[model samples]
Target chain A: MASKTQSKTTAEFADDPINASLTADDKIELLRKMVRIRRFEQTSLKHYHAGSIGGFLHLYIGQESVAVGSISLLGDHDHVITAYRDHGHALAVGMTMDECMAEVFGKKTGCSKGKGGSMHYFAPDKNYWGGHGIVGGQTPLGAGLAFGVKYLGQKGCCLCYLGDGAINQGAFHEALNLAALWDLPVIFIIENNGYSMGTSQVRSSAHPEEGLAARAQGYNMDWAQIDGVSVYEIRAGVNKAVLRAHEESRPTLLEIKTYRHKGHSVADANAEKYRTKEEIQEHMAEHDPIDFWKSTLIGEGVITEDDYKQINKEAGAEADAAAEFAIKSPFPDESEIFDDIYWEVDNNTEAGRTGRHFFHG
Target chain B: MPREITYREALREGLDEELAHDDNVVIIGEEVAEYNGAYKVTEGLWKKWGDKRVIDAPISEAGFIGMGIGASMLGIRPVMELMFYSFAYVAFDQMMNNAATCRYMSGGLINVPIVVRGPANGGTNVGATHSHTPENIFANMPGLKVVSPSDPYDVKGLIKSSIRDNDPVYFMESTVLYGMAGEVPSNDELDEGELIVPIGKAKVKREGADISLIAHGRAVVSSLAAADILAEKYNINAEVLDLRSIRPLDEQAIMETVRKTHRAVYVEENKPFCGIGAQVSSMIMEQAFDDLDAPVLRITSADAPAFYSPPIEKLQLPTPEEIVERSLTIC
Candidate 1:
């Protein structure tokens, strides 16, 4: 109850104007974060079109609010691991956009020190385990991390994020069973973008499932569904889930219902063929978390339209600057190729010595 | 300094010694605690160490194996037993991606000091599904130390060393040799602490001049038998080298023997193609080409799956007679 009250009331400050619990600076910070993700995604799409970014590039456009809301609820000490659609997640976790952009550009300045490209990005110093490319790969790893925290007698839990497609994997079941069996402190987030690659949920499933959290029933886990588009909803949902996991030392699965505006990747030939334009328009009107946040913040007098515009402008400039830095950065040297493939062996003394040592023991 | 004991008893003693020494050490697997382990390698451990350690895990390999990795990640040294070696394939994903590579993936953030022990190779009437010699698979994987001890002495020393080492070790116990008796050094008998057989080192079982014979796991015992036959009948004193660990192969020891002996013969229980023998042979050619007096020879199982028929199985596998004949021809 103490944790629930702490998390739920923490967000009321931004929700209620009379209470004024959230400071003006906090509101500005939130706006800046959302704007940063928005600008980064837009510019990244341009880079993708220009063939600067190859491989599978899944833009975090409509789902920006989820990262903003959930990451806002987390502290610097908290750990996070996520699926391949991870640029926004990394930025929210406090990695510089230039490093992330360069990582996407496969430049040496990337967050992974340029070894791991966009998908496999890992920044352990910042408590980000990785940007795992495999769908359900992060669940067991996240659970193991939480187990480590608990065993070491630490005060942190791991927030493991995956996609709607990943819940069907065997690793998800194995991870959840172990997490529940051990009562590990972990927050499992399923960002349900309503499609597994090009196939719709209806096509993938035999029985129509309402939310990703429903599958948690198979493992007898604590679960809930939320409107992921709304930053307020995501914040409230994650805050509750995270606190519950930490306090009870139990794993909680939060299924955030959101939609991706673009196709699964850049190579979708007939993106519009899968779904009707009417369905897209309907979601845009009913469930645009960005639009909802703007109206709520404005209506509550938390910020003005001019403030929003200035934040957007600043974010755009920052994204442009990051792209410029990434493009100008030098490619990795050839000498680096042989290094870091494995742990370097230090045998400098033996290097100069040619003959064998003859000793009688 | 040596007392006779079975391989199974030696393994049990190893677990007992580790638990007695380290408070962080724990044992988990199917029937490992209450039922005295599937192979009974952990007999009486539960009574001695209590239930907190020496846990009896459920029938979930992935779950318990992942738990072992999780526990190891937090400084708990867990020695997990997969009842049968063939079943390890179920937990291969966790073993390979998580337990094996966690330290490297985490930028050497921590070490995984976990030992997965089980009985491998087929001598029992168990079907093809239940019987598989997967030493090559574990040997092929990086970030893992694979050790297969042939006798009680090596078993006790290697198991103790694996528990103390700061790497994930896979100890494949041969079921065929579990009942076989051999001398193991006692605690009071040893002047120092427990004997630690270094990883990636080979032991020379017998010395000879004509040809060198390389083997590992249970095949080491088989090779010794073959070497004696060659010495008695063929008048060929074949040098026998027992490769204890396969991953960081005792290449130096192997090369030294091959170069001196002038002829080499590799013996293994598994099939010949792409086997550990192939790796050893290629390395010998690469490094000791000038010293070789004759072509390298290999004695291994045929390119066919092992079946129930003992007569057929005998024909399929390389025996002492075959080894002596091969040694004479090569010499």
Candidate 2:
């Protein structure tokens, strides 16, 4: 079983050796990435309301640190895959805001050529597999990515992120068993954001006190809990799992206590009804990851309030430009609908010409 | 001369040849590696390839199937097996939503070069839960390629083509036909590409001018037997067209057969409503309506769950008698 102990708060967390090794520039870059994600998500919500970006917009507003911190520690062989709430991970792994926003806008220049909307960003060249849409669907894929890394004799791990609600899914549990049974190099990051859609964690899951990661004990895999409010703590905690994967080819379950300020998606009309406004406001006021990190940087004399404002402004401008670029980009042509359905058909190989690959043609 | 081999041996030979052909190819499923396959189709593969190439997974279809799709995205060609095709419902989301759509959804950036193979047939007294023919269900999806080979020759060639095709191919086999023997190319002939059957190409198993019997998988065997009975008893010459691939359907072959015979009878082990025969019947009516001399009739399994009683179960699936009776009406 997972330990029932509470996660250490940012203030309670001791000096992070990983943070200590980071140069002043590296620390600022982490802060910048978080702010960039925040601004990108906020802009997406604004456009979503204005009827520009269609489909579900699962914002990564409050959980930016988890993606930025963990992804920053990834080596060349390391890979990343996540569920629908994936804008942060996409941007963290070097996917440009223009391509991502274009994808959300359903433009041809988008990362997925506008075929996959907000929930399906992919950059295989960068080792970012996808932004899978189904709940608990990407968990098995994550384990498979690790299996590929191990099979190819690569020295790295895969960081598969899922929500607290997904931990209850049968696929996720099955993936955990396979990862442990095979000793694959993967870290299942459960971003426990207090609520799954309308239901709170206590109502949706069992053993809330023991934490979701405790279920890792059932698989005989290592488990831990981390304070998601601190980027330093997230990096330190995930770094340990990455080392275990690289050196031992083992799996770990890390339950990062995080919070989401917005609704499950921009269209979740009952976001306020299910959870009290006070609860949302309280978390925003005290446990906001961005504010906590910004203040910590200021206290350390690495950055001032003026520098934070400048960074925020730049992120906002960059997001605005991306949205503008998405607006200007063209949608894919009608002929393109049948293009990517098969590799053989797309490349016009000898086998491609033999059959009626498309129904209409 | 090509050597005779059972359907099981042909599949094993195909897998072995592919594993030897490419280092990235692997086999993963429950009982696949150590247990030598639930049906013994993978006998001695574990010893030949060792554990790295042949892996055993728990009875977790969604986990391992989705894992194969993921690995395929990273340049690994994984051939995953389901102990029974009826168990595909457990991993339908992964197969339909992920493996089928990964390439299209990824804008052609990722290719899910994975083959999901298993026996899909009824009439074995395994009850309803274990018997299901989902070729039509999978063929309905746009991005998926559905193959249901009837004989050992087609099975060996199609399995190889499916593995190398760079798409998600759902290869539906038959447990009843696993032991059936048919002529297959020798290993030396295979090396020179003698038995490499292409996808979406139908074969004229037997030629006649009176009627056409269109079928796939085990039903092809039934149809061929019916053609003999039709010629011997009723003096009706029937053309048997084996529709080896369902999704990328060989419309040209179907039309040619229809044009030659001017009458058609579709047969399959699948149920009738919205089945593969239904699609073919609709296509003939739409494209070759003038070529037809009579309405195209269909003979299929009884529209109910597979019966557990061995005697009744034998009558539940399509048989040669059913095919001959249905063909007589169309003729």
Candidate 3:
């Protein structure tokens, strides 16, 4: 439960103010989301291994708290755009599990209507930008969304999530400077899972001493990184940043320091070569966000052992049902291929008067 | 109140009018404000509208261009200006993948009404890096609309319409024609939407029968000039067809022109390799094959980057002399 306020990853739940503020139902609901994300990702991983889904599949197992906590504080007007590690972000933005899973299965009923696979899922109506495939690609778009909020005179903010490697990108710095100069409402979230696919921060970044958080100082913006293993702590960190973004039209660089239990993607075969199995197991056993919340709930006597079991069972069934829906959904028809390419409104009555679209020479 | 104005002034008027017409419209780019734009196309609008509407952005094309796309989806119509068309490579991903595809990818749930306008031709001896006519590259995109206007009248009308369009429009301008004076109607002289040239329509700059000279942007000027030379010297009557919109390519107009002349000469400022002329040449071959009296000729830039030297650059792009010669050969 250690967070920005507590300033210690070693701190226990006694000093965690978020827990005292939230009700038992609230805490259980957060746990349910974390469990659902874990189950959904686990099921997706199993299917990828079984060859149900084609292309690279990036799981959000150990880093569930970042999406669960950060999304909880966002209003419906607030937007979210993240890298391909985005199943958790999609679900958190209120996309149905079936829709997200159907996209993974490349089905017609998918959120992106099967055009965008797992790495390119989008649900704009839900304010979720996309499941962008390119690393560090979503950084500029994040600032762009915030610039919209400012331009439209909307009292809202945008949360842009990217990996540790994204901060090194020139566009990232450019976006930060633009956001700060224009006073755009945006939060740049560096989800530092400590590796750029296979290479760790030690091998990737220039200023790895202070980690990704230190670079925000170069942009003259407020910055912080928190223990991403606790959803409560993650929420607390994002709460201040989001408030800062909306109230003052200030952009913040908030890094969620966590680890992914799986390889970078289903195709990352050499993950073990870069990291040891013992190191992986140790993070899973100790810093797992889902397990941490589960024990915290039980220790607080918020839920019984049976209740926890029931939650887990429900989460598993939901993930299984989502997969089943995706399996039953049909592939997009050939005619549908040319349908959404351009909106039909422009083809209708336009502003200009030349009805005939040609000049007879 | 029809009066002569420079193409740059006409374009600035269009942006200024659009900004006044709709609160959602804003001009965003480097030097678009305090510096009065890279080419002075947005000279006084920044002072007129202030920083709220006319914004001066960093030299980060990818960042601001992407931001413009995002802002447009949320109902802010962004007129993003790249210093040159070649700079589109910096924000190519956002321009192609995000802006162009957002409407389609979101199942028509989102609309990106952003106009990316800048000079696209290479006649200033700026070399290969600064001079690239990317009409073919952008027109190839499905969801994105590509517009290129020739005269001041067309530029004013199309730029306004491109800003108001409910789609991502890549408005390619000509640096060579920026200061070229042309007759443009005053706002009081024209009715609403009358001055606004619709996308995807071709204009008949001149009518003839011997050959058809088809082009867009600055090449349209050469095509007209070539038509005059062919008429005066060779006694070959050439019809000049200026394609205002590249994407919604007026195939009917092309067929009409080819059918009238029975010979077609496609000219463009872009390189010959996979240029707009190539597409038009094939379209005439496939669609209006029976009407053609001779093989369609394409007069485009040399299949290489622009030369730094003025003399070499002059030989690279399609010239009026070359177009006249190509037209004569085809006729």
Instruction: Identify the candidate with maximal lDDT.
Output: 2
| lDDT (C-alpha) at residue A66 in model 2 | 97
DockQ in order: 0.27, 0.78, 0.51
lDDT of 1 at A290: 71
Native contacts conserved, per model: 0.12, 0.71, 0.45
Winner by DockQ between candidate 3 and candidate 1:
3
Clashes of each: 0, 1, 0
Error of 1 at B60 (Å): 2.9
Query: Among all windows of ten consecutive residues in candidate 2 chain B, which has the lowest summed lDDT?
Result: B187-196
Given candidate 3, what's the lDDT at residue B299?
A: 90
Candidate 2: residue pairs that collide: A2-A214
Per DockQ, what order, best first? 2, 3, 1
Looking at model 1, the pairs that clash are none
Q: TM-score of each candidate? A: 0.87, 0.97, 0.95
The better candidate by lDDT, 1 or 2, is: 2
lDDT of 2: 0.91
Which candidate leads in TM-score? 2
Tens digit of per-residue lDDT, candidate 1, span B1-331? 4589998998888888888888778888889988987777888889888876788877777767766775675577889898888888888777777666555433344457788989877656665666677887877766676788888888888888778766788888888888889988777877886766666668898998888999988888888998888878878888999987775567788998997799999988877878878878887888899999988888887777777777776666677878888778878
